[model samples]
Target: MTYLVNNPADFVDESIDGFVAANSNLVRRVPGGVVRATRTPPGQVAVVIGGGSGHYPAFAGLVGQGLAHGAAMGNVFASPSAQQIYSVAKAAASDSGVLLSFGNYAGDVLNFGIAEERLKAEGIPCRCFAVTDDICSGPADKASERRGIAGDLTVFRAAALAAAEGKSLDEVYEFASHANDRTRSFGVAFSGCTLPGASQPLFTVPKGRMGVGMGIHGEQGIEEVDMPSASDLADMLVDRLLDERPDGAASPRVGVMLNGLGSVKYEELFVLYKRVSERLEAAGLTLVQPEVGELVTSFEMAGVSLTLFWLDDALEQAWTAPATTPAYCRGGVALEGEPRDDADLAAAHEEETPDASEDSKSDAAGMLAVIETIQAKIEAEAEDLGKLDAISGDGDHGIGMDTGARAALSAARRAVEKGCGAGTVLMRAGDAWANEAGGTSGALWGLGLRSVGACIGDENSVAAPVVAEGVVEATDAIMRLGGAEIGDKTMLDSMKPFSDKLAEEVKAGTPLRQAWRRAAEASQQAADATANLAPKKGRAKNHSDKSIGHADPGAISFAMIVSAVADTLESLHEDAA
Candidate 1:
C-alpha cells in the first residue's frame, strides 16, 4: 500500500511534478510528459516511449541520453490519451522523424495508433511498434497478442540506440520491431500490488501460494501453486523462457533482464539471477549483459519478470550502447550537455475558431447543459461503476469516468461561454475527457465525441436528423477506432443499440425527444444484457468468464449518459414550450 499520497487522484500529477524536479539535471517536463534535458544529435530521429504511471524507471526515468528522447506519461495504470501522446510526440520530434514505442495493450494501441496518424498528417514522419513480449498471455503462434511485460526495456533500448546512432525513422522503427519479435517475458508474483490510496490490492494471491504467469499490473496469474525455493523459481522461469526461444538458434546469444516488479529487493534478485544464470549456461546458451534488478515495476507488487532478448550481432551492439538515465545505465558515464532545443521542439498548433452560426452556438449551450447532466449522473454512479469493474478488471473505471465527465463538462462550458458551435464544443470536451481520464474508455469516448463533432459542421443547422446522423457516424468511427464488435462486451454494446435506434427513429420522422427516449431505452437494455456477455479486451481479457454475471462498467456508464441526454433534451423541450 502506498501511504505517501495525499489524494489518489492527484498521485500521477504530483509524482510527475516531483519527478521532473528531482531529475532536473536529466529530464525536463513537457505538456504530456518529460523530455530529456540532454539534447539529441541534430537531424537525428526521436524515439518517444511511454505508457501509464506507477511503472517508474520504465517510462520517465528512462528519458535521457542514449534512451528515449521523451516519454508520454499517462495516469496510473492507464494508457495515455491520444491528445497527450500527440503533444509529447510533437515536442519530441526532431528534423528526421519520430518512432513511437510502447507495450501492446488495447488502450495504448488505440491511443498511439491515432497519434501516429496525426503526426503523419502533419508531415512529421512517424511509425509505431508495440512490444508484445509476455509469453504466458497467449500461445506462441499468437505471440503477437501477448501483452508486453519487462521486455519493454529490450525493445525501447534498441529503438533508442537506433535513434541515437542517427538512424532514419524507418531504420529506428525496424530495429524496434525486430527487438520486439526477438523478446519474450514471463512473470510470477507472491502477492499483488496496491494502487495509491486503494483499500486493497488490484488482485490477491492465496497465502503460502505463488501465482505463475502474473502480470506487472496485478493481473491475476493463470496458475496458482505452492511457493517454491529460490532455486526452483529460477529454474521455472528459465525453463519457461527456454521453451519459447527464437527460431534458428541452437545456441542463441541472449541479453537477460530479471526485473523486480516492485517490492523484491536487489539482494533477492541477485540470488534468483544466480540460479537463472547457472541454468542458462547449463543449456549451452551464452548470456551477454545480464541485468539483474528492477527494470519495470508496478506500484509495490511483490513479483518479478524475466525478459529474454535473443540478440543477433547488430542487436547485441545496439543493446550494449552507452546509456545514462535516472535508473538503468550501461557502457560508461556520459556527460549531459543541454536539453532539447526549444526552437526544434514543435508545440501543438493553435486551434482556429471555425465560423459558426448563432443558432449553432445556441445548440452549443444545450450541449453544455447535456454535459453537466452526464457529469452528475456519472458522479452519482461512480462507486457502483467501479465495483462492477473491480470484479473482472483493475476497478478504475468509475474514477476514470468521473474524471473524464468533469473535464468534458468543464471544457464544454468554456466553449459555450466563448460562443463556439456545438461541434467545436463537443470536440474540445472530448479531448479534455480523453486527456484527463487516460484509459481505454477515455480514448473511445474521445473518439466517439469527435466523430459526432465531425458530422455536425460548425456552420450547419442542428436538427434531429443531423444529430441522429452524428450518432451513426460516431458508432462507425468508434467501432473502427476501437476494433470492438457489437458482442465484445464493451461500451459498444450500448452504443451500437442507441445509435441504431436513433438513426431508425429519425428516419421514421419521429419527434427528436421521443426518438432519443426510444434510443435511451435500447441502450439500457443493451447495457443490462452485458451481464450475460464476457469481456474480450483490456484487463478482463485473461479471466473474461469472471465478468459473466456483471454488466460492463463502460456499457452501464454509456446507458446512464444516454438517459441523462434524453432528460436534457426533454428539459430543452419544456423550456421551449
Candidate 2:
C-alpha cells in the first residue's frame, strides 16, 4: 500500500519545510526548494549545493555552519529546477561571489548552468563544481563522467569549509575540484526505492539479484549480477576504486563510507564495513576515516554505496571539521593510519592452540551433536521462511537466516572440535555467518549468535542460575551490537523477555529442565505479541501496516528455535540424571 502524504504535488515543499523546522538553528529555505544555513552571512563567497530531495544529506542535510551555504532541492530523484538553483545562489551570494556545486548529471548541468548565467547577469560572480565520482556509473575511459554518489559529501564538504574559512570564491572552487579529483564511488541495489505516496516501486530488481553500479536515484547500473557475499561485494567495489585510482599519491589517505539507502540496517552495514576493510588492506590502501549509515538514501530503498576519498591534509581537515546537519555531522580530527603489516596478518591467520578439555573425544562429540541439530533445523526451515517472506518483504530473509545458521553451526563444531572456547567458537561462527549469508537478517542473526557464544565462553556445563544469567547477558550484548532494543519489534523483543524470564525462574530454584520449559513458553508468547507491534525499526519498518498484523519472521523463528534448543538441553540433562 502507498503512503498517505498530504499531497503528492507539494511533497517536496512539505519535506523541505520539515527539514528546515527540524534544523532551524542551522538552515532556512530561500525561494524555490533552496535552503541556506541561518549563520551564512550574505556577501561571503557562498557555496550552493543541491540535486534532489530523497538523497537527504546530499543536497540539504549537508548545509550547516561549516558546510554549504545553501542547497536547491528537487522532487524525489529529479534534478532541481533552474529557478531553484538561481534562488539558492541569490540567497547565499555575497560581495565575495557564489559557487554552485552539484552531482554531474545532464539535468543538473543544464539547470545549474542556467542558474549560473542568471546569477552572472545579476552581477553576482558564480562558478560551478559538478561532482562525478562513481566508477560504476560510467566506463573507465569516461569514469569521470559517471553520476555523483556518496563521494559528493567529500567534495562539497571541502568547498564549504574553504568558504567558511574565508577562501575566495576561486579558491573554494579549486578546493572542491581537487577533492572531486580524489574521490570515487560505486553502489549496488538489492531493490529499488518508491516515490512518496506511491504503491509501486520507482524501479524493479529481480529476486536474489543486485544491480551493481546502480545510481542513488534508481538509474540503470553497469550490470545486474547475482547477489554475492559482503566480502565479494567489497572486493568488487575496492577493485574498481583501485583500478581507477582517484588522482594523487601511490598510497592515498582514504576515507571510506558504506552508505545505506534509507532502509538498510546498521547490522548489514557493519558486515559490509568488515569486508571493505579487509579488501582495502589487501590493496595496500590506508583507511583514514570511515562513515557508515543511511547518510544519503533513496526513499525506503534497499541498497548500499561505497565512497572513497583520496585525502590530503586540506581535505582531511575539512572532513573532520564539525558541522551539524539533519543526517550528516562529524566532529574532531579523526586520527588515521594504514592497514596492519604482513606479520600481523600472518599472526592473525595462525592456527589456534587447543584447550585441554576439548582434547577429550566425548566433549568434541557432544559439541558436534548440538551443532548438527541446529544445522538440521535451519536447513529444514529455509524454504518455509522464503515463502512467507515473498508476500511482504524481500524473500532473502529465509535464505539468509538459513545460510547464517548453517554457517554458525559449522563454525561452532569446527572450533569446539579444535578445542577452542565457546567464546572463540561464537566469534569465528559470526565471521563465517556474515561471510556466507546474504541480506540484513543474516548479519543480525550472526551478531546475536556471536554474543551468545561469547557469553557462554568455554563453559562445559552450567547450573540453572548460570544459564539464566548467561542468556540475559547474551541479550544485552545483542542489543548493544545490533543497536536495537527490546520491543522495537525486532528479534530482541522475543529473545530478551524470554531470557529474562528464564533468569527469574532459575533464581526461584526451579529445576533446569522446568526453567527451560518456562523460558520456551515465554519466548513463544513474546513472539506472538510482536504481531501487534508496529515495526519501528529495520527492514520491516518500511511497511508499517504490512508488519503490524504479522509477527516478525526473525522474532518468530528465533523464539521457536531457541525454545526447541532449550527443550533439547533439558532432555539432555534428564538423560544424564
Question: Candidates' lDDT values, in order?
Answer: 0.85, 0.70
| Over 4 Å off, model 1 | 38-42, 333-338, 341-346, 349-354, 570-577
Top candidate by TM-score: 1
Alpha carbon deviation, residue 140, candidate 1 (Å): 1.4
Residues 144-180, candidate 2: write the lDDT tens digits.
Answer: 5567888888888899788878888899999998888
**On a 0 to 1 TM-score scale, where does candidate 1 land against the true structure?**
0.95
- Model 2 lDDT-worst window of ten: 333-342
**Cα distance off (Å), candidate 2, residue 345:** 57
For residue 75, model 1's alpha carbon misses the true position, in angstroms, by 1.0
